[model samples]
Target: MRALGSNQAADPPRYNATTDLLERNLVAGRAERPYLVREGRTWTYEEVVEATDAAGSGLLGLGLDVGDRVLVATRDRVEFVFAFWGAIKAGLVPVPVASGLSAADVHFLLSDSEARGAVCDGASASAVLPATRRSDVPCVLVGGSVSGEGALTWEEVCGRPASLRAAPTTEDDVALWLYTSGTTGLPKAAMHRHRHLRAAPSALSRQVIAMEPDDVVLSVSKMFFAYGLGNSVYLPAAAGAAVVVDDAPVVPGRVEGLLNRARPTLLFGVPAFFDGLSRLEEARLPDSIRMVISAGEALAEDLFARFRDRFGLPPLDGLGSTEALHHVTSNRPHDVLPGSAGRPLDGYEARVLDPDQQQVAEGESGELWIRGPTTFAGYWRRPELTARTYSGDWMRTGDLVRMVEGRLFCEGRLDDLVKLGGVWVAPGEIEEVLRGHPGVAEAAVVTSDDGSGVPVLVAFVRREPEWDGSDLPAELRRSCRRRLAAFKVPKSFEVVSELPRTPTGKLKRFVLREQPSTRP
Candidate 1:
């Protein structure tokens, strides 16, 4: 949990005003206004300018040219911000790699991007080691000392003067490359331009978030991901607000303590953390919190309702992806449906299409396609994937959804739909029913086969604190049978302490499938 001030000054005539995205209002912003906070210290907008300038100048001193890819492997702390903006200011392409990437994934990114340099903290340092050993480059280290061959300390990265000009770059120049969340396989890098940063804050930040100058933004999701990058860096900077960064493991009690201490006005987290937080014992939200944003996965209706009842505000649920940059569809404060995914933000368009590629009706579920200024140019070095997924302005999202008379209802992924008794079933429907039960704290439904050719629906349940496993499985089964059709009911229920989850709180169904059967 470190606070890294990220403010810079205007570059020379070679640099256009737009190229210096962060330096747009360094002088205009209130000098004493807090721009960053960690633990007990705070950095003003003016102080951030010095730190940011120092980082950029230091990188330039390393003899790296413009457009050379620099790998940014750090957490949600100041070092991450410094390296990210520093490389951008120096007219270099910064690849913001995920913190939890494995050795193979790290090798793929470094080799694919052809990175010239790297900056990382303790968490990501180990992964970078093998990559550097194979490619031999300058590496800047943060947090703690690591015995490494190519590693340079953070102080070395900022050892230069506190004044440096941003490189002269056009709007279409490569700005950053965001690697996709690697739940499986080698992650693809989504290439974005210098101008792509504008659409996210304008549509999602202004129209949907309604971020104010006084707001203090806090995010449970780390900054490496596209969703976290927008809320943590883009939105907060655009609104002249402060950002709170914490790299610790996210838990209900730990999050509660941070909230009470920081008292952030805007809170952003995934559905998994929100569900747990809502069910915490004697949980009380901070008075300063005005909004809570849910994304990454579908937000369950039960968790949403319980959270709304506990806290006086309905969580602003939205849908976004690594390729889309940030949020595309979001719910506003005045208009929010309990289960619906809400409408797309201004400047973004969403169209649902059937298997034939023809458009579908508002209420009929179809594969989602989106087109907007925020969409990335394409995946790096993946022309076939790029061609298959993107066509002109529209990108096939691979998500199944229905507008349902103006409100969006996500019907899981296109592949998540399963066949049961000669009928197609969406796991969301059964999961929704299970979540409605008082004993259920969290639930997920997936199809599996037990050596018989026939596929059966299996339900995984995590019971709430108030209820033990006693009779809960039967109770949940009975509840689902009463509400849903007989064919849609789960074949068996497995009560467990927790479900398999990714680092970002997303469920890893592929991993769950490998576990031994708990069948009775």
Candidate 2:
């Protein structure tokens, strides 16, 4: 890990948003040092700085102005990173829309965020262009042919001068607007600023991952998601470490391949990705893998144990949201406790408060709230939501959790609980019970209406080959009845090939609830 400068307070806190941390650090390093890698090609720190500068100048020449929002809907390519930093260099806010979003969702985000421009890849460029047309935003096609009228190619933009610079940005100025995966409703844009970028490397980088200059970090999420963007792009760039970018989402086998090819010391992903990778029979992970970090969703203890059994390394679980830049609380590798998102990172404070906003006793579950440097400025254009979510400096995480010996145990989302006969029951508890069954590979429990039109618990099970779905539902129901309250046992069971999930690997319960009942 590189030595961070003094903790001593300086006048005005030395905040500079004109130049990105990547450019500043790269310019300070020797020109020949490798800073980025993609498909066996090495880009020196100086080369990366120059490439981003060229891309920035191109966007400027294309009529982008200060504070203009540029939407990046692409995979994890080296050029994608360049375009992202380029937007920063031009004083334009970069909004990374997920390339996998539905066409309607894409149109909604473009309109909602009021993006003035978009840069898209070949696969999604066509699908997104029509949506962009309706919003009157220009589209810049990258790794794709320009088909839409008035759309410009990435080559045209990069052809501009690399010497252009933008006016300085302030700490409070919005730099990015990331949309949260709308598991419940339409995705809301979480506003971030230049100062938020400084928090990850400062608080969570060295303490949790112990990142080193020689280390290669492989992020399993896309650059559009906050976790992936911070872990793979920002942290490595700021720490002067090497990062690997692949223009593909992390699949089960591809994750193992990337690990072997990059020989990364650190791997970051959500729990579902880890679960899928653990299921692979041929994944021979490199011995150089020193750390595995899990975030984006709560990790199951069984998944953690499976990882430990397979790789001999426990997956460190962290709790965070898009509202908070990356992670507010993470378990360090050496100090990790199973099922606990460890104590607050340095320079942050956390609390578990009851409905009255009073502190709860230890070992009691309450709403988890945090006050940290990485907390977002606010939600974009949603003053009512901003006031509801933010109280003074503390950001309400909307997660229900309990604290034991200062460690946090994620119970479930505050809204994920279902009322059965007037008693609150967490769906995760039912899912956990189903996961303990030997035949179950993956399980999701959701509250849905039965054929008779009353709210009933439904368990969707993806079973191993030997288990018969026909008989397993009854067996699992009996098991749950023995372990839980009679009313808490699932009244309906449906076998599914796979559960729908977001790009970040969170189970899409909203999608699951829309399915017709499989019950008789």
Q: List the RMSD of every prediction in angstroms.
A: 4.6, 4.3
lDDT of 2: 0.80
lDDT of each: 0.79, 0.80
TM-score of each model, paired residue for residue: 0.92, 0.94
User: Model 2, residue 181: what's the lDDT?
Assistant: 84
What does the lDDT come to for candidate 1? 0.79
Tens-digit per-residue lDDT, 1-520, candidate 2: 1001112333324343436567656544545677778875989778887888888788767677877888898878877788888887677888887887667877888888777788888767766788888787788888767896867888887745478565455565667778888888778988787778866687678778778778888888778888898887888887778887777767879778878978988888888788888888887789988888899888888889998899888899998889988888889977988888888888888999998889999998899999988888777778899898988999899999998988899988987888887888888778889989878988888888766667888889888666655688888888898898888888888888899988777888978888877774
Per-residue lDDT over 1-520 for candidate 1, one digit per residue giving the tens place of the 0 to 100 score = 0001111234412432223445554755565687778997887766766777788778767778877888888877886777777777777778887777776777788888888788877888888876776788777778778556777777866644578777766555667888876665567888887777755678877897788779999999878888888878767776778889787878887988999999999999998888888878788888999989989898877778889998887998888888888888988899888777889888888999988889997699898999998788778788899998886789988888998766677878876788887888998888888988888888888877776878888899888888755788789878988999999988888988999887667777766555656764
RMSD of 2: 4.3
- The superposed Cα distance between candidate 1 and the true structure at residue 490, in angstroms, equals 2.6
